[model samples]
Target: MSAALDTHGKAHDGHDDHGDHGHHTPTGFMRWVTTTNHKDIGTMYLWFSFAMFLFGGAMAMIIRAELFQPGMQIVTPEFFNSMTTYHGLVMVFGAIMPAFVGFANWQIPMMIGAPDMAFPRMNNWSFWLLPPAAILLVASFLVPGGGAGVGWTMYAPLTTQMGPGMDLTIFAVHILGMSSIMGSINIITTILNLRAPGMTLMKMPLFVWTWLITAYLLVASMPVLAGAVTMTLTDRHFGTSFFNAAGGGDPVLYQHIFWFFGHPEVYIIAIPAFGVVSQVIPAFSRKPLFGYASMVYATSSIAILSFMVWAHHMYVVGMPVAGQLYFMYATMLIAVPTGVKVFNWVATMWKGSLTFETPMLFALGFLFLFTLGGFTGLVLAMTVVDVQLQDTYYVVAHFHYVMVAGALFSAFAGVYFWFPKWTGKMYDETLGKWHFWLSIIFFNVTFFVQHFLGLAGMPRRIPDYALQFTEFNQISSIGAFGFGLSQVFFLYIIIKAIRSGEKAPQLPWDGADTLEWTHLPTPAPYHTFENPPTVK
Candidate 1:
């Protein structure tokens, strides 16, 4: 991951080149609204994702509050279902996916030695599409019959019978899909065509490699999702029977298509996270990443295998013995490449000059918890085990471990790792560390107990539970509130860093050797590589 750059023909700062017509950056609110600069757009993506994170987190708090006791306390069961559905939808599409795209917008060009995204104008449009989609999603709650409660998967017959809000939800999903496809196109084009002279594909950073594979996954699978929803829309109104059982369509067909996309969608979120951890672990360990070529191969392997394992989610949906066996073994096959990634990260840190900076701490946290998530996933991959725990809180605990600990924690690590480059200042290290500990502790408290709850035969997505489940639910709820507050503290740390932190030097991390750290200035110039740096 660490490569030296030839300093010959060094690129000039963007602000330094005015030519005949001086550059005129837009002022006030319009600066953000109209800007084509990658940094400006990335900032907007980050803030937007954080906003959605809060919205989703608030929904989670309500859920926990109601589940704090054994009976219904606040929301009606229908509304409770809506909260779960919307929270999952908002966090996955609105928060996690966009957050990585934000990182891509900010980092990919600079890391690969390109001046900007391949299509800057399209980049602007990609971001602008998100708000309308988000509005549609949020507004669904206010409509007659409230939001669709068919779960985040928005499964069949139930979705067809849903009210006007399902229409809104479907349309919102369409818009979000459009936005992702455009962003993926931009990333793929930029990475493939825009590398500096002499920087080959093999020479790209692990983060770049991870995203390159991820973008391919997005381009392929997002359309499948779009198709699934479109079919659902047609069944709802246009007399199509794509998923309508009464109209001669098999509802199970919807599960086939949805999980085909859904399983890869899991990787689509996770692969980029793997990329971030790959970068963080190597840098803080003060070692060049162990087995860079192997990591690339492993990532590609995961993407290829992701398509083969979708049926594991549908084991209890009733397939043949042969079908179940194939899906089970194929699903377990994913663990091999995933295990390679985990091993490489640990090997990268083994007996090296180590540091526990906030970024490193979070990366370490991701390593432990994400592996735990993978183990749980393995447990779920068995046909018999999944039949027993299919819709239980165990399933909930497994994925939250994967999504929250895996993706969200990695995003935190990336932000802290690059905060100096973005802000041109140092955040208070103590406060940042405090934020991390609170998050990891509260995070474990919240989700770990759910595994036991699932094992004890408690089902998920219900507002009420049997009396025996009350104590763990209370513990989980208390931890949920703490986790939510810890994020609030994180927002404070970021604001304080932007406003009053100490000035940063050109290179903050001694071991960070990418173009952004090695060739670019602190608070990287708005434009870079007007003349691409030569890689020796």
Candidate 2:
């Protein structure tokens, strides 16, 4: 690769111009193998995340199929357990987290006028770590006893009873942790150290700010998870019994440690979605983000509050009344900052020149549905209510609303919002609308009934159910299939857009205010900001 040149044909260190914009991009397979370019790495991350999405969706199909008629007609009870376990693990770690990281890789540098990530080689290493870790996770299922059936949480005593698959899950978690930590460090360094001459921290884009907070959340919380899982591994193999009551260790200790990590892990997935919505809402509304300073504070508060509420997930575990009360209030307190965010988004869109582009549609969908999820979560935060609903299908409905409808929808918004810049081509608007409507309707079809199921007494993680629960289960199953198939339509839209969609203008969205849209070239020069751009 040759040295990159600026728009004026001068490199940063005053070298001569490189031949063409694409001149330095290595040809053939080695391009992906050896490149340190953030765009290429980001593209790889996005594609990898999508592949895992499909794989995890397939697992979900198996699960829904087994639950369709309440008789275990498809998979065995054991396989059903494994499917549940890995489906959660894959969707969270493989699909959602990495998709955001991919967005960071592609956008952060451009957004802030940096040429590449601060630690370029380390960025490459971080992404490459995911595939091997993913392999360990997927390969675990083919082992003699199938994968860990202990659910993604891998609670302690249940974990100790697992087969070789547990070991693989442990390793995969460790590797994924390492990758996340490295990626966080890279994001922190790039945003902190590599911004243009005048781009101060307060002046950075909201997406950049969200990532900065998310990276910290990852750094603070991943180690706790690592420690919890490591103890589980020891109990299973070396007989340390860190969670064994016979060895004077309480299983509740694992819950404390895991949720300490798990609760923030929720924000780690969500804050970025918030960032995406922040960016998209303003762009479509033709207004500045309504509360930039407040948005930053709200995000920071949410991250801080995330730590205090980890115990909310354990209200049913027989903690003390005082402990339950404290967690309940702390959990509910999260709604303040969250409500601030929702208000700010609506205010940004208030009476502005709003347009219903594909991205804006998804962002609006996220706001409506995520708020519904939040209300349900608030209901669960009530200690008395949670005890009744814990481990039931109600719990399932709450999170899918937050995760699939919330995080995943915003992710789609981000992709559609940025698709033009990424490919320098417009996606088919008609097809995009079709995909969104189908997803919205089917997603509701799938999980909405589970709310009633939980209220009426249906336990989760069970292969079969009582005859009274059969009708809702069948409805939910059919909805799940329709939702899954909608993505196939989504995939086609994306491919068609990339191959032969209309050529997008340099600033595809007229409301965009960021440097990437204002200053960068269409298709974004393979090498961006070779000469650092002035923020003003």
Candidate 3:
């Protein structure tokens, strides 16, 4: 009973008593296969996300392997296109999307002192939809026409020409986007309505606040995407001229709607990472976050700015010069609020007694390298400069710096930071350190040179390139392979920690001061906060 109690010694006697024996545990494979407990749903999200991560990484490996030799040694042009398309789709919708949701599923109810997500069964529906959708995306490769060869953006006419696989991929994107909207709404309703009686908005943790911001973005952006993609579907099958220039519709219009949905989605991924690292750094640095109020305002500012900057991605699409300049300058303005965030995080650690735990290492790495990515983004923000760099390897290097080094690294940070709380077991600090160092080193080695390759006029998405670029390509391929392999170490550390490790305490780190820390255990119980603990 003591073990089962919330920190306040509250015990649940099951939601209802079925018989003398007990209430059902919702046993067998169906528990995961069909159930919707936040914990179970969170497990599904994390595993699904990891699978997507591995699969996406494999696609990258293929791209790297193909690029290993200069002249399209291993694959044809068609197959190479599929690899890039699916990799981007899988990484964005399948991997990164679910990871943030997984955090929401696991942490929101606990953090907000709710019994569970508001629509538990709908939560089940939301998660179950993912595998089917993912299968559709993956199965696109096997279809008679090959996979969607157009990029994940699925720009029209080119996409319209692709095989049956493209149709399946189209349907899959719509489905995944819908699932995300549903989940975001649930998170919104649950956080807003189900919070404990006294927990005010500002009192909520940064993680929750960021999710709140994210869910709003999701609710607003996803439907526009659904509508746009749905229209794309109609244009392909139903003879509408929405994105078909030949049918009196301008193809450029699709870019506008797609990006309307697209730009906010970037922050949908990064804001949660912002929340996660915000939590990790403060804890390890033994200080409350620096400028907590500013951090909140900064996050809100980033979200607001997301809507206005969508056109920046389309700078080279031959928009009027005035339009291009407006986007460029407005996009450049995001850096100010973003800079506020980076400054606040550093200030959080400044002059504090700090520890070099794995999470903190990853968090710090995120700050440094993600800042580099942001700077490159600023460079790309110059409309004149972007005319030269657009669609080149420079753009490739810039975004990968942002997405891979930024979002991916932050996910690793959160996992390490929260591992003890999730598993009630202590990970081997030394192995974690090794994993961190090797990953950061290899990651930089792989992508940093890509900027040079791009500026040298090497385009992205090619199966092969000119002979002059061979050496860096080879070294990059080697680094890419090493980077993927090093994840084995990360996996081993997690499994080892799960199976057997030193026991961890509720407040495993001295400075972990959240309500979740106080109310839960080293590995939190399956259902936490049956009755909300009074926040001290």
Candidate 4:
């Protein structure tokens, strides 16, 4: 018999045939509310992330609108600042991060030939914790004195002066941190302890390997963020002075602590993205991943180097020249490993049978735009150039290129790549391509000009600018609106696929060789790998 079938001719290797398991599966709303099934929780995480993405996108609209024609046409400067702050917070914690965790939840067990996450109930808890935290974060906007206007970094002193909203933000951070730590623990345990009998450590898929590294980054860094916020909270209410200059604390101390956590948090978002690209590029190229072992080493190197370069963000905040030099060199060092991964991706597609599927298109977009972002990052890595551009729109452009192009684009690619398996329905290919073209074009239209504006000395986080900077701002605002509309179209495409698209075959992509594609059925099963398939 084939590995996917039994002598009786019923599919037996945990195929999508779930008739026998129906009774055991929970139905109705409570299935999502109380269930520990990794797939269900993964679904929840994805939807939640999308919802937050829209919410954050709306805030971006407000920010863009206010800056559409210069002098604060729509919102008060204070509210504009709040929009920028919450927009960053929601997108980072609520949208991008959760989306990847969703991917991890769905793919890890299937990829490793395991039945469920290591801590199923805790998995349930980890997801549930997020809604309350999101509520706290969003609700802060309505609290007395409005939302915390201190950037997402929640810098001290300013944070200490904010009202009840700051408390809500702090508490929300605490809850979110708890959730991340729990999720990391679960991921680490599952990947480390639950692989199939013959799948050695180095034998795992690139996605699994990337996530393993990200989980450790989360475990190491989340507590630091929690501690930073807790100290801010105490300084606010208890007269403690961890960041209060009057109490012998230096505010710059807060920058040091926050960046230590912050820099790793950047990779906590980007590394999984690198993993997604790793999987998509290889599959679409119809080739095995180039330099698989080197990719793994490069990922680890990036993580290790992430810790050494936190002070780069602090160079302009008044570091000694020696400190600046060390950080400058350290920041530039990240490019080496990042370059290796980029080289391997291109080499994977070299002379290969390449096709421009939606996933592949987005992966290629990520490769080009993310590398552009990295180059700009190198420009800023120099202490002298950074001193000139810190807090300018140049810095803003670099960040979005890395973030939107790097993380968000890869996320879109992963969604499209796995959508067939997840929903057992193929999306409208035409619409998928439309979404890609519109997003990539408008994304560049929005951010590319910001580089020039920053070079001309347009500072970020401000509502208005001088007339000299007006044209590029107008161009950026228009592009922002167009980019926002493209994402809405993306939503429509996803819903249409799930409800009325063509049914997908069991193996949708010929080049995909993971266990989920090779051994499981389309849409996957309520239970998979009940009996693990040993890897060669």
Candidate 5:
């Protein structure tokens, strides 16, 4: 964004009127292919993320399709296992993670009043890493034994026992890890150094603050995941027995290390959702975000608590009672800060002039359903409770709520909230409401029943089921199908909005106080602030 204007009052782009950017005349698809503009890159990242969501959602559709009946009537058990593994990896890495990066790329520059990300060339390189990594991941299915069937967790002994597909999966992880590390470092440096003159740490927008935290978390935890995979690779090829009990290595240790990374890795996928909600609720509620300082504290609190609770995920695998109790309480402590966040959202809208536009509908959906997910999480956090609930469909149900209903829903909320700004066109309001209601309703239907299926003693990772789960599974499958179908409408809404929808004005929502709304345009151009625009 522009520094304070000169006495003559022209926006400074760090260039003369006749400079390169001044006359650059933005045009070309090749510009997108080679451009390093933050807006362009951010848009690319968002679309790619959505594409991966569909790609992986297709797998979820398959899994639900197969489970529609009592037996493995569709794919083989091995292939079913591959679907789970590939779907998890692809969604976590390829979808949710990239979408957050997309948000950061799109917003962080403007939020801090900078014209572009700190290291533009490096931004290009980080994005380029994605395709090769995606190719390797997709290639694993064509390998002899099919893809990695060990599930996305890829716990050691099973992973080590796997075949060629494991090798490809490992390579894919390696490349993806490198990409993430590069992206994290770039984000940190950009946020640290790229802000405009007036913005300070506390003055910076909530989105920037959350991203700074997320970048640090990525740097700290992702390498641990890479190491865990490395050991798995070595055990498979070099004869190391890190996970082989017979060879004097403990498989459980791998779980400890993997989850050391895995658990926080989940938050790595989520903290941005926290940031997105923080942005949307205030914009639509026509109020300042309630407890802004408290929101920042709660985010940090959740990050710190995230590290401690990684062990909670390991509780069912068995730990000493003392350790288990400590983890149980520590895990429960997370609920406090999270509760603060949810309350802040509700309070932001408590007595305000709220409108149930598409964005608010999504934000509201997140508030109710994500809390339900959080409640289920707290239930599983108890030491005794987890023992009974662990590894069953209950755990699966809980996470899907948190991730799918919580994180992914928030993502859609963000997209709808920001679509006008990004597209310069208004979405079909009636159609958007339809997408939101059906998606939220069907999502709960799909996942809520799975909890009982787990409590009813259905184990996960099974291709076949006994008769007791028949009815709930049938309902869950139908819900999943409906949820999947809902997105087709979402895509239609977006396309129709872009092609022939109503128009959106700058400062689309009066309460959108962020610099992004004031300083940028609907369908913001290929480049913004090639010279700074004053934030005023």
Candidate 6:
């Protein structure tokens, strides 16, 4: 294998320019179905995730509409529960996870100078599994009892009592977990084995580092989730007593098992977001990341600690005081690594040539809001506090801050940072800023008040609220509507960029040090790094 010219128009890979590698590339719809190209597959993953985001967002709109005036204005209580259940499911599984995977599909190979994923066909299969799972999930809403009314947590006793919709949710969970495990396997294999010759373990970019860690977390945790759901399925039909207290089973045991997987799942959503912010902040600030090695260690530390803290979520279940103290302390330990990451990001930007481009703006939003979420999480980590706030809107507010601010905001930053590279066209900057500011303002308006509602004794996952909770719910609903609509501007910006926009420069940003910018073509070629580029 000979090397080729990198996007720098330099001989980073000493191969002949075998121009236009698309001869083997297929065309049209069948091409998408049958293709194994990482770029094509990544594009599919992104579109699918976005469609799910929209579908889930629509469900959110219904939930908010019902709560807008607290009188069952839009949906029945049962259907409201269904909306809440599937909304959480669709957003977490269908939206956030796939979005990160889509990024992995697109960037990981380019970042590591690998030709493609280690198992490209498995990569394709991993993505293809999601649609059926999503279909079953959505179709459950039309079934006899509507969708599962239990929350996305699907606590056992409630889960066992639901109708066929519960069964659909269980099956959907199994399929989704299978997809996650396969995707994790592919990522781990590629990151481990397929780096270009000179890219050592420590030499890879932060995004690669984060995914490598995230893949491990996925492999470790997804199966536990699968086991939990499988037990649910058995209890539903196979006469198993895994969670039925009437049959010598313990519902608290279900909570234990579920949170074991659930706590780690939080970082599974978050670590990749950390990776994105790590890349973007340094890029716009024109500084090397302040503590690259420390960043890696902190991330790993967080992943390690995630497994130890699951029971913090179950403090209300009357666990032994020793167990509660241990989990609470362990959960609090997660803050050390997370805070290190935040500090490093701040230090990287300190006294540097910081520019608030769309990506930077979003990254800043992520840092600020995510820190606030972290603080709330600390409060919730206390056994006594969590006992009070466990099922309230406070928990809802806490996670949305983390999930939306941490994951979704960073995802937006990533799209803006890389969109030019992906599409060969620049998005409208003014519109981009508009989207960011509106989203940030309205997002705070939405969830910020939920903290008050939770403290004021407003419960979550409920369709109607008492008169005392009325004004806050109304404010939150309005904000939700605004936040939801701002994403339309985002979609428009993306479509406009793809269809007709200014051509992007090969190096669109000023300070990026990664191979994707340093080596790849302006619009990255269909087949890249055919001959791996040796890292310095």
lDDT of 6 at 136: 97
lDDT of 3 by residue, 16-106 (tens): 2223212454445654676667866886798789889999999999999999998867878999999999999999999998998998898
- State the C-alpha lDDT per candidate: 0.91, 0.90, 0.85, 0.91, 0.83, 0.90
Model 6 ranges with Cα > 4 A deviation: 1-25
Clashing pairs in 6: 2-15, 3-13, 3-14, 3-15, 4-15, 7-519
Write out the backbone clash pairs for model 1: none
Cα TM-score of candidate 6:
0.96
Candidates in descending TM-score order: 1, 4, 6, 2, 3, 5
Is candidate 1 or 3 superior in lDDT? 1
**Residue 271 in model 1: lDDT:** 98
lDDT of 2 by residue, 25-93 (tens): 555666677778898789889989999999999999999998988676888899899999999999999
TM-score of each: 0.97, 0.96, 0.95, 0.96, 0.94, 0.96
Clashes of 6: 6
Q: Once superposed on the true structure, which residue ranges of model 2 sit more than 4 Å away at CA?
A: 1-26
Position 372, candidate 1: lDDT = 100
Where in model 5 is the C-alpha error above 4 Å?
A: 1-18, 21-29, 531-536
- Candidate 4 colliding pairs: none
Tens digits of per-residue lDDT for model 6 on 268-365? 99999999999999999999999999999999999999999888887888878998899888888899999899999999999999988999999999
The C-alpha local distance difference test score for the whole of candidate 1 amounts to: 0.91
Question: After TM-score superposition, what is the CA distance of residue 158 in candidate 5 from its true location, in Å?
Answer: 0.5
All predictions: root-mean-square deviation over Cα? 4.2, 3.6, 3.4, 4.1, 4.7, 4.0
Clashing residue pairs in candidate 5 (N, C-alpha, C atoms within 3 angstroms)? 1-113, 2-533, 13-531, 424-523
